[model samples]
Structure formats: C-alpha cells, structure tokens
Target: MRADRLVSLVLLLRQRGRLSAATLAHELEVSTRTVLRDIEALSAAGVPVYAERGRHGGFALLPGFRTELTGLNHDEALSLLVAGLGRGEQVFGLGSALASAMRKVVDALPEGSQATASDAARRMLIEPETDLLARRAAVDEVPGDVAAEVRRAVFAGHKLRLHYAAAGRPPAWRTVDPIGLVTVRDRGYLLATRSGEDRTYRLSRVLAAEELPEPAERPDHVDLDRIWRDRSTRFRAGGDQVAVELRLRPSRREELAGTALAVLAEAAEADGVGGAGGADGADGADGAGGWLRMTVTFQDARHAEWALWQLATDAEALAPPSLRTALRDRALALAARYDTPP
Candidate 1:
C-alpha cells in the first residue's frame, strides 16, 4: 500500500505541478508527516522531486522530469479518463479497480497527452444517471456482495444458484449455467442457460446468489453481443403490444417517446395555437401552441394508459376508442375517490 501511495504521490506532483504537503496528504489520505516522508523517499530514489520554500511553497518535480512509460494517443487517453470518471465505474462493483486503472493510464501516457486528456475529460460527460428534470433514471439497486458473487461465478465458469425475485412472482431458488453479465442503461442482467433454455435475469432482482462447485456446461467461447441483441429483439416483439395515437404538448413528446416501445408515426396537429384543453376535447386535450399528434406503441393497454396519465394535463390519448374509454374511466374513478376530503 505504501508503494502504491508513493507512486500516486509522484503522479500527483507530475500532473499538478506544485502541491503543498497538506494538499498531497489530503489527496493521498495521509498525514502531512507521511507526505514529507514520501517526498524524501522519492528524492532518495532519484525521482527528481524537490521542494519550494516560503508562504506559497510546495513540493514539485524538476523541470522536464517524468517517468518514461507506454504512450497513449490523446483520444485513447481521453476516453479512458472520461469512462473512469463516469458512472460506468459503478457497474459490477469495480469502482475502485477502475479508479486505480485510471491513475495508471494517466501515468503511462506521454506528458503532453496526459494534460490534454485531463482537460478533454473534464469537458465530456457520459451516460448521466438523470434527465433534464433532475429525476433519476430507474436503476435497480443490487447489493454489492450479491453482484460480486455473480461476477465471480461468471468469470470462474461455475454454475450459479440464485434466490431470485422475478417480477410478480414469489422468490424462488434456481440453478443455472453461468454465461455472462451484461449492463445496459445502468441496469444489469445475467445471461445464462437453465435446462438448455436461454434465460436472462436482472441483477437487482437477485435476492441472493451462490456460486456452485461444479463447472458450468457451456461453450468455450460465445458471442455475447449477438446473444443480447437476439434476446432483446425477441423480447420487444413478444410483448402484448398496444399501439395508441395521442395528441400531447410539444414539451412532453420526449416523455411519451421514452416510455413507448416504438413510435410508429408522429405529426404536429394542424390546429392553431390555443389554450390547454381538457381530456374531454375531440382529440382528448390540446395545449397552448397546439399539440403534437403521435402514433406510438406501448407494451400493453395498461402501459399506454399509465404513460399518458403521467403527463396529466400536458397530454391526451386519441386512440382506438377503448383506450380513451379506459383513460376516462380511470380519471372518473380517481376524481370520485378524491372528491370528498379525507
């Protein structure tokens, strides 16, 4: 650990130019004395480290001093830096390992590339876990230990036993041949096989996991991307899909598109700008500046109603009559329930 800290100290000064003992201690999570000692050790090792004096003094490397290491092009270094700093590090319980790897990547880059990569990384953001409204996207919370066990089984090629809580089903135990793990949009899935049948289980729904002693029965190599694509295609095509037409405020178009399985068609209403209309209007509702008319597909009738209802006054379903009736009935029930003060 001390060795790692010493290397990190050198990297820090090399990157930041000059840093006070207190700053180094804070960055390295050690005491000031430890920082001073590490500096002495680096100097003794002929690392070209020296100290500045007076009020604005700090430790710094000699001019043109840097460790000779493998080089990374600016773009390559920048990608690693951004990914290391982003939310992807939290996937599969590798946050600390990813951070360590990032430090090493920076240390390996050519001096000029290191500074440029750092600056570019600061300008880029990847896969932010929230939207413009400050609402966090739904990422299921899987316990770290459970995720680690699953990851271990996947890497070790062992069968896995899962105490899984599948949606709307009682928690049950099942053993499956470990294939691989896949993460999309911050959600994790275990792609495996059960009794020769393909299966994909969400990591968050895994209440507990046990790595089995026996080796998994599987191919030596697998194309995981193709497998995931095939499974996703089947899932999208197999659902109880319901297509609905809706006229909604332009501002709410994205919200609608996001929840829908597929957007079959979209066109702005020809009607001129007007005030917000109620769900009782001929096309359900129209907002000021008119509304966008879209034909979108949802997982089911229930899904369609729920998506539209989320927009409240900003949207209205103008659909296959049945959907409109369902929405009206739901609204009436809600209205009646809230009619009297509770």
Candidate 2:
C-alpha cells in the first residue's frame, strides 16, 4: 500500500504541479503528516521532491522533470492490457489506433513476461459480448465512410447535413449545428441543434452525412456533461409521465433503478427489506405473498405498459385503475389468443 501511495504521490504531483500538504493528503486520502513523511522519503530516494513553507507553500517536483510508469510489473501490465481489450474505442472510430497502441505495449514488455501477460489478459474479459444468460447487447453499425464524415464535421466545428431516419419516420435531410458526440451503453448519439432547438440524433440512424464548410453556430466551449443532463431532464419531463405503483421483491430494487424510470416512493419492512418503506402493496412483484412496494414513473402510459411487459413476473403494477385495467385487458387478450386450439 505504501508503494502504491508513493507512486500515486509522484503521479499526482506530475499531473498537478505544486500541491499543499493538506491538498496532497486530501487527494491521497491520508493525513498531512503522512504526506510530509512521504515527501521526505521521496527526496531520500532521489525523487527530487522539494517543499516550501508559507500560505502558498507546498510540495512540488523539480521543474521540467517527469517519470514514465511503463516499467509495469506483471499485474500492472495485465491490467493495462485488459483495459485495451474492450470495443469502447470502436464506437469512437479509434479501433485501429487502439489496437496499434495495445500491440506496442505488449511488444515492449519484458521478453520473459510477454507470454504470461498476454495469456493472463486473454483469459480475462472486459465488456463481454454475451452475458451469463446468453444475452448479447445490440450494437449499431455505422458505415465507415459515413461515420468518418460525421466525426470530421464534429471536430471541425462545422454544420452537418444528415439523411436521418428517426424511428418510424421516413428518411429526411436535416441540417444541424453539431455540438458533440456521446456514447452511452454501446450506443452513440450526436448532440446538436436545428433552428436553435435541441436535437439528439442516434448515430446509427444517420444514413448519410455531409460536412458543410460553414462553421456550426455552437458555443466555442460547451459543458457537454451539463448539456447532456439538462437535455435528458427536459426529454423525460416533456413526455407523458405515467406513473405506476409496484410491489416488487427486495432483490429487484437495483434492476428497477437501472431502468428508464424513477422510484418515487418505497415501502419495505421486516420482509428482509432495507430502509424506510411505505409503498402501496396490492400484491408482490410476483403477485405472491411477500412484497416491497414502490411507486415508479414512466415516460407515458405506453412506456409504462412496455416496461411492465418486460418486467413480467418480477414486478406488479398496482395503480391509477386505468393502468391496471390496461394490463388486465392485455393479459386477457393474450390468454384468449393462447386458449384457441390452434
């Protein structure tokens, strides 16, 4: 742990020059006294670490000096190699570059450690293509040429004309002032605006793209994180927010949270459930005895219906009469269809 801390201290100082002992302790999650001792230790070890006293005084490394951590011991190299095995770079159109870098790192490893490192990294997986249940995440394929064009336009800060097919809508040409590209859950989206209206387009849905020489009318600097959050909030709020009260099992709380819905309230008790609970409990998530109730918001009635359909036996929708009635009607129709001899 001390070795790791020492390395972390060096890295922190290298990345952010001149940090007070207090700040160093905060960053390293240690005490100021520990930081001072580490500084002395680094100096003794010929690390050229120096300190200053006063209000603005702090610890810093010698000017114009830095260290490379490429001499990675077995586990370190394996970890780095494993990280590069993911297809994350593919979505950003950096697959070849990433592969080349990974190869270089592997080739540069100590001759004796090369085989061991590669074997270990190969045995492990990051973002596996299939889950334990044999479920595979769907990946959208964008034409290489099209993706290249869109990428170029985005970085060049230029307007883009796209032949986009949005959901059930037919393909149409639209000019957008491209802001940035974002990838989430293996899917990529282009954040942009049309006539000053915020618009988000799925990259896969872009059938064709052309870069315009005219500069895009976008802010010179953008807080994409904030913009993405604000856009998401607005999108969720603008739609029909039909809500459903569910009596779920204590175990499925995480699954519920991961969905595109918000839990408004919950009710869990000695049922081995945790935290405060006062949820409506018509029945369990499985329509059985035990239950932890929760009220969840959906985009709309249709959205609620679709999500509940997927949740199936794991969640029970108990609310607003209309929603329950809709589920019942759908269930009856399905049952009636199955009841037929054919």
Candidate 3:
C-alpha cells in the first residue's frame, strides 16, 4: 500500500508541479508529516525532487523530469480524459485508482495534447449530481472493505458470502456465486446467483462481505449486458404497476414520464379539454389550454398519487378514482398543515 501511495505521490507531483506539502497531504488523504516523509523517500531513492522555501514555495520535480507512458492520439486521450470526469470511479471504491490512472493518462499524452485533453474534459460534464431543478440525486454509499471483497470474489471466480440488508427485510447472510459487478449512474450492484437462481444485490446494502475459498459455479464466458437487461425487464414486469390517465401541460410531460414506470400512451387534447376528464367529477382543466393526455404506469397507487402531487395543479390525474381521492386528501391535509402560518 505504501508503495502504491509513493507511486501515486510521484505521479501527482509529475501531473501538478509545485504542489505544497499541505496540498499533497489533502490529495493523498494523509498528513503533512507523511508527505514530508514520502518526499524524503523519493529523494533518497535518487528522484530529482527539490523543495522551495517561501510563502509560495512547495515541492516540485526538476525540469524535464516526468514519467514516461506514451502512446495515445489526441482524440483518444481526450475521450479518456472526458470519460474520467464522471462519478463511475466512485463506485466499488475505485476513486483513488481512477485518479492515479487519469494522472498516468495525462502523463502518457504528448506534451502538446496534455492541455487540450484536460480542457476538453472540462467542457463536457456528464451525469452531474444535481439536475437543472437543483434537486440532488441520492448517492448510495458502500463500505470500502465490502466493495473490495465483493470485487475480488467477482473477479477471482470465488463464492461470496454477503451480510446483506434487502429492502423491508432484516440483515441476513447469503452465499452467492458472483457473476460480475455492474455500475449504473454511480450506483453499484453485484450480479450473482444463489442456488442457481439469479440475484442482484445493491452494493450499498451489503453490510459486510467475505470471499469463500470455493470457486463460484459460473460459466467461463458471460454476456453481462444481456443478463442485466433480461433481469431488468423481468423486474419491471413483476411489480404491481398501476396505470393512470393524466391530463397535464405538455411542458410537464417529461417530468411526469421521468417518475412514472412507463408511458403507455400520449395524445393531444383532441377537443381542448372537452370530455377529457372522466366521470368521477373530474375537472381536467384549471383554465390553462394545451393539455396533453397520457396513460402512464407507476409502481403502485401510492406511487402514482405522489408523482402527480409533485406537479401540483400543473398536472391532473384523470383516471383511477382512488388516485384522485388520495391526491385530494393529501392536498387538503397539506393545506390544513399550512393553514396556520409559521
């Protein structure tokens, strides 16, 4: 581990010259004392490292001294740099490795391309943690040791024992044959099998993990993408999805679709909200024209109610009498709660 840390230290200095000991300590997630010791270690090992003493002084390598790992074209290097700007590396405890690898990638590029690649990466932002609405996405936190053990079992083809806490269930231990690890939108999942039945466990829910000595019972070759797709399809079809017809402003259609499980149908208001509302005393229009009718599916009645509620008066659920009732009840309760000013 120290060796890796030392290599990382050198790479960081090579990538960002004249970084202060405090800066190095922050980057290395260590202490300034440790950084000083590492610098001493590098110097003792014949590395051409030198220090400057002043308010603006820090450690820097000698001119023309850089690690060589060349052989990447401009576009190729740019793509790598841009791809590395995402949070994918945070999954499975690979953040440190990803940082080190990116440093190496920058070092590998020709001098002329190094700045260009970094600039290109800065211009392209991917999967930001928050959206345009300022709503932050939830980040699932997985334990370092658990992720490492799970990754090892998955790669080494060893059986994995996981102390898992599934939704609505107590924590329990399970022995599974790890097939592979998958990361989507910064969330990690372990694809595995228990008693030959497919199982997918969210890494964040793994309280602990252990790699068993026995080899996993998995095929030598696997189409992980296809397997994940099939499992996702089955999961979507298995839930008790509730279908509801909604009359909403066209602008809010995307927002509704995002929360719903599926958009079964979409159509313009043929007669400008005339007869669009069903007979549960439904008043589809709040006097705003250009409403769109959609049949969307949600995981359950409660899910549909909650999603439509978020749109407030902009969207109105037209069908499933129960959903309208739930929304009305929620609106009344909310109004009553706010009836008294703070």
Q: What is the C-alpha RMSD, rounded to one decimal, of candidate 2?
A: 17.3
List TM-scores for all candidates, in order: 0.65, 0.65, 0.85
The predicted structure with the larger lDDT, 1 or 3, is 3
RMSD of 1: 6.3
Taken over the whole model, the C-alpha lDDT of each candidate is 0.79, 0.75, 0.81
Decide which is better by TM-score, 1 or 3: 3
Model 3: residues >4 Å from true position, as ranges?
69-86, 272-289
Estimate the Cα RMSD of every predicted model relative to the unseen true structure: 6.3, 17.3, 4.2
Clashing pairs in 2: 267-277, 267-278, 267-279, 268-277
Tell me which residue pairs clash in candidate 1.
none
**Backbone clashes, each candidate:** 0, 4, 0
**With candidate 3 superimposed using the best TM-score fit, by how many Å does residue 140's alpha carbon deviate from the native?**
1.6
Question: How far in Å is the alpha carbon of 6 misplaced in model 2?
Answer: 42
Scanning candidate 1 in windows of ten residues, the lowest lDDT window is 69-78
The sequence of per-residue lDDT tens digits that candidate 3 reaches over residues 1-342 is 676677778878777789999999988888999999999998998889999999999999998887653344332343354355456556677656656667767777888998899899789877888999999977779877887798789878999999999999999999999998777777888999999999999999999999999999999999999999989888867778899988877778888888988889998877634433443223443544467878988988878888998998677878888888888888899889999988
lDDT of 1 by residue, 201-262 (tens): 99989999999999998899999999999998788788689888777788888778888888
